[model samples]
Target: MIEELQDVPAGVVGTRVSGRVTADDFRDFKPAMDRMLDAGEVRIIEVIGPDYEGFGPGGLLADVKQGFSTLTHMRAFKRTAVVTDKEWIGHTLHALAWMIPGEVALFGMDELDAAKQWAAG
Candidate 1:
């Protein structure tokens, strides 16, 4: 499931993901992002909990579609902060960071506050 983080400052969009992620979740997620993007450039903070069980096949496809859509308007995102305890996820973000237009930072679960601060900036 995906839930929007409600306490973030203006210009920053945040989401918390747990359990199994599905295309349906993106259905909810995409609109929030679109709304934020429509306004102007925004920063993102994603908090992936330990219960996250990866994405379903449909979610993967949805991700591809959403990814392309986001890339098409890549400049809309100023920065992305990911908070997770998983090593693999952090490594993956680190590797992908070099290819992305904006900055991407990974933080351990304990550093969620710091991640939010960074993304808010």
Candidate 2:
């Protein structure tokens, strides 16, 4: 499941994901993303908690479609912050940083506040 992170700045979009992610989660996620797109909020920050498993295959395909559809929005962002307590997630983000259009950063649970600060800046 994913819940919107409240109290963030106007241009920053944030969410926390947990448990076994399903296709339903992606369906729920898109509305928030579409709202941001409609508002022209280009920057984004996604925080996936420790309980996050992995995306379902269909969920993954939906994400790829979202990425392509929002390529311009993604390119407008100066940074992408992925907050996780998982070590592999950090390593994976580091490895895939180059593939992202903007700067992609990973932060541990302890550094979440810093991650938000960096992403919001």
Candidate 1 lDDT tens digits, 1-121: 8899998877788899988889999887888978877877879899999989999658889887888887767777788999999888988887888876577888899998898889888
lDDT of 2 by residue, 41-97 (tens): 455678888789888657777777777887777646577789888888888887878
Report the error of model 1 at residue 57, Å.
Answer: 4.2
* Candidate 1 displacement at residue 73 in angstroms: 1.5
All candidates' TM-scores?
A: 0.93, 0.86
Model 1 residue pairs with clashes = none
All candidates' lDDT scores?
0.85, 0.77
What TM-score should be assigned to candidate 1?
0.93
TM-score of predicted model 2? 0.86
